[model samples]
Target: MLLMMAEVLAFSRVSEALPNSTFWQFLSFHQSHVEWVGCSLHDLIQPSFSFLVGVALPFSLGSRLAKGATFGALLRHTMVRSLILILLGIFLRSMHSEQTYFTFEDTLSQIGLGYTFLFLLGFYSPRVQLIALVLILVGYWAAFALFPLPGAGFNYTLAGVTPDWQYNLQGFAAHWNKNTNFAWDFDRWFLNLFPRESTFTNNGGGYSTLSFIPTLGTMILGLFAGKTLKDNVAPNQKIKKFVITGVLLLIGGLVLHLTGVNPIVKRIWTPAWVLFSGGWCFLFLAFFYGVIDVANYKRWSFFLMVIGMNSIAAYVIADGLGAFIGNSLAIHLGQDYNLLFGLPYATLVKGALVLLIEWWILYWMYKNKIFIKI
Candidate 1:
């Protein structure tokens, strides 16, 4: 949630302000999404969020079941939550558009598209869940690998890729190239079914609705981790399991990419990316679990806990209210107020203020016991 807020607050502008500082530049690079074929800190944000959703499911399911909820009730709630998430994603994406943007590539919509399946899988044994994960990964990979690449006479420009586009992969890997692969073609048909300002073309960033498949795989991984944590096992065993699984996944993803069997493309949520990003997600969970839960280092995470608890609310505020808050600050404080920190730091100051206001909103929600869940 903080990372999402940072993106909205334009924290990367700090790097722009401090162009000469290598440290700031490095941080800024990670703050922004990578163009293609590589992972950045920002790239991991969506995967982490999606993965954590799966991680939380076991507890959520257990709590509701213990409260005497039936499968019918839980399934209904899951459907409703999925619908809300999908519509919410569209609404947020449409905030600046002419008509309702029907894109389903955003994080929420992508998760929503797969949440029902994830929920259904939660009822099964871990072995079944693992089987589902393998099927999803392999099936998705094969689908892409089998999709025919563009012919020589095909116009790259029509698909928004230039003839000499630097990121275009060659040979088999080209099957996952931006704007020209299976998901892109699928969206060409699927998204146009809804109302649009114009005919839907390729998503500029190559994100596709079909990515929800592998995203489900990511969630399944989280499900495994969540179950491990929730089970009556020693802390060290859980930590060990997470670490070993993380290492294996990381290596698996790298091997796939290195072998040119598949590429790790987050925009498309390629199967290899599921393994790669899932690896990082596991390691991250292990670290946090070790420090906060096992080691009892609770005090420092209070700030994060506030945001984490009200993540949906925080997400809404960050996406919906950031501009309003920034404008309000400028109205009250004067446009030049940010310049107090000098010209280069103007963006930094304004963004910092915006972040503080957003955090306070979450803090207020936390204190008042007003978490917005979906």
Candidate 2:
């Protein structure tokens, strides 16, 4: 959550302050996923967030079931929550627009698109969920592999690829190329079904609405992890399972990419990307669970808890309130003050102040026990 909040502001500041700086470049690498392959902190945000939703499902369902909630009631709640998330995503993306963007590629919208399916999976056994996960990945892969690859004469430059781009994969791999894929094509039509000021051509980032299909695989991985955590196994045994599972996922994802079967591209949320990101999510969960849940080291986690407890509010504020808060700071502190210490340092100060204020708001909400759950 902190990473997502600070990412754009911090990276832009550093890059603007020190153009062509290798340090900023490396930091930006961590802040954004590579276009074709590799993982990073920023890329992991959506996956981890979606995965955690899956992680929480068992507990949520269990709590409701314990309270004698009916399946019908649960389904109704699921629909409402999903709708809320989708609408909120659209609202956030349309903040500075005249009309709704109607985009489904945002993290909230992507999650919302698949949330119902995931909720349904919560009732199934782990074995069944694993099968569903496999099916999703394989099915998505088939869609790509079965699609016709762009011909050799096809223009790459128009699609943002260098004419001499060497990373271009051959055979079925070309079907999964950035802008010229089944998913991207489907999006060109699907997104156009909504009101638009202009005809939809392509997502500049190469993201597609259909990426949610493979994203389901990431959530299913979380379902497995949540099941493990909810099991009657010992703490040490659970930790071992998590670590092992995480390692296997990482290996599986990399093997696919390295063998030229699939490239781990997050923009389209490819199957390999799902496994790779899901692996990191599991490892992250393992670390936090090991220290706090297993070792009972709770003192150092208070700060994190404040943000975690009201994550929805934190996310909304980060996305929608950033500009307002920045401008407010500029007014109070004077724009020149930020540049007094140098543009780079000023950028850092402004970002830090914004984050601090955001944290304080979250902290206040936490203290008041006002968690805004979707």
Candidate 3:
């Protein structure tokens, strides 16, 4: 979560601010997903965030159940949390805007949209959860696959996509093409139900509300991982399960993409992407669990634990108050103050300062035991 937050609130902006060089350019690329084919580190952030929410759910559910909370109470709590996440997502996207954004493609809204289902799955056995995951991935894949593909002579230029965008796969694959998919069509109808600055068209990034379907699968993978962690197994056995499952999922996703059965597109949240990103999430959980909980190497993780512990606060403040902090710094310190090596570096300095401020806020919260939960 800290790494993902840093990418959004720090590295991406810094990459743009730094002078154009091989290393910086590479950093920039890693900070953004490939146009239509492959994933990037930045692309994993949302999925990772969603997956971690699932990973944490087992623990949360266990606590509530142990406290004698009824299933009805749990369901109600889940609904309320889902509502807050959706509303918070919309509110955050509307930041600095004149009206409510009503966009459900943001990470918060996407998670919110699928969170209740995830919570429901948390009560089920691992076998049921696995079946649910398969059903979600397959059902979502079928939705796009069965959607009629754009006919021949369809003008890509007219669709606002690149004239020669990659992976214009024919037949079923074409049904998932950028800006021309079923999800995009649904967004036109769905988003238009609310107020808008203009008629809802396409998300500039090729994302859609329907990505939540596959995102649920990502969370399910985490749900399974969480179950594995919570089960009464040896630490080594649990870690082994995580690593092995992660590797298998990674290979499975890669094979699907390579064989052209599914294209690994992050924007549309393809089934392949769910497996791919979920694999990475598993690996990440394994690494962290092994290092901190298993090996007891706790001291080095203190800084990260601060941000991780108060992720929502960090995320909301970074997106909501980040620009204000940067502007304040520029106003008081002078715009030229951030110009370390050159004018191009100004944004880098300002972004770094903003990140520092965000970290300090998280740190303060951590010290005060003020963790904010949805």
Candidate 4:
């Protein structure tokens, strides 16, 4: 969550400020989303967030059960939470629009769309979860593979893709190409069902509501990790399991990509992407789990903990309040204040100030025990 906030609040501006520096250039590459294919640090943010949701489920369910919550009660709460998350996502996306956007491609909405299924799976055995994961990935893959590609006379321009666009995949992999696959076609029909200023043609980034299916796969992988953590295994064994699983997932994703069986496109949340990104999620969990939980070296993470504990608040502030705060800073501090460091670094200066204010807000919330949980 801190990373997600930082990417918007400060990282992009800082990267822009140091355009000629190799270090910042490297950071900038990861800070921004890739156009169509492959992964960037920025791309991992959504998957990681989704994965952690699954990781938390085991603990959440245990607590609820221990509190004598019945299955019906749990189901009711999950449904309400899912609805709120979906509406919250739509609300956030519609913040600058003329009306409610009614898009389900937002991260929160995508997760919400799949959360109930994930919640139900949380109650089942690991074997069932694994089988479901396989079925989802394969079934989604087949659906796309079976969807007819655009015919020769089909106009790519209408779908926001140029005929000669460099990233357009060829052959079998084209099934997952941007704005030209099953999901894109589904959106054309599905999104148009909602009221709109104009007909919904395609998502500029090629993200689709159906991506939630594979996103559930990513979450299932996290569910496995969560179950592992809850097991009565030794710390070293847990770390080993995570590392092995991470490597295997990475290999599996790469093999599919290399063999042209599937492409690792994050935009559509392709099945291969579920495996690839899930690998990174596991490794990250292992690193943090080993460092903070296993080694008891928790002091250094308090700053991050402040934002992470109140993540929903942090997300809301980052997405909704950032421009407000930035404009206010300019209003009160003088428009030229950020230029004190020089014109090139003006964005950096302003962004840093905004980020600081955001952190302070989170810190205040932390101090007051005002976490905004869904």
lDDT of each: 0.92, 0.85, 0.84, 0.90
Which runs in model 1 stand beyond 4 Å of their true positions? 8-11
- Give the 10-residue window scoring lowest on summed lDDT in candidate 4: 6-15
Q: Which portions of model 3 miss their true places by more than 4 Å?
A: 7-20, 152-158, 166-172
- For candidate 2, which ten residues in a row score worst on lDDT? 156-165
Q: Once superposed on the true structure, which residue ranges of model 2 sit more than 4 Å away at CA?
A: 19-23, 152-171
Can you tell me which runs of candidate 4 are displaced by over 4 Å? 9-19
Worst 10 residues of 1 by lDDT: 7-16
Q: Tens digits of per-residue lDDT for model 3 on 1-374?
A: 55554553344555666656677777777767777878888788888998888889999999989999999999999999999999999999898678888899889889999999998888778889889988988898888887776667766554667645665666456677898887887887998999988877778889899898899999888888888888999999999999999999899999988887788899999999999888898898899999999999999999888888888998898778777888898899986888776765566677778888889888888889999998
In model 4, pairs of residues that clash are none
Of candidates 2 and 1, the better by lDDT: 1
Candidate 2 colliding pairs: none
Give the per-residue Cα lDDT of candidate 4 at 86. Answer: 94
Q: Candidate 1, overall lDDT?
A: 0.92
Q: Write the per-residue lDDT of candidate 4 for residues 1-374, one digit (tens) a residue.
A: 87677764355566677677887777778878899889999999999999999999999999999999999999999999999999999999999999889899888999999999999999999999999999999999999999988889987887899757899999988888888889989899999999987889888888898999999999999999999999999999999999999999999999999999999989899889999999999999999999999999999999999989988888889999999999999999998998887876677788788888999999999999998988
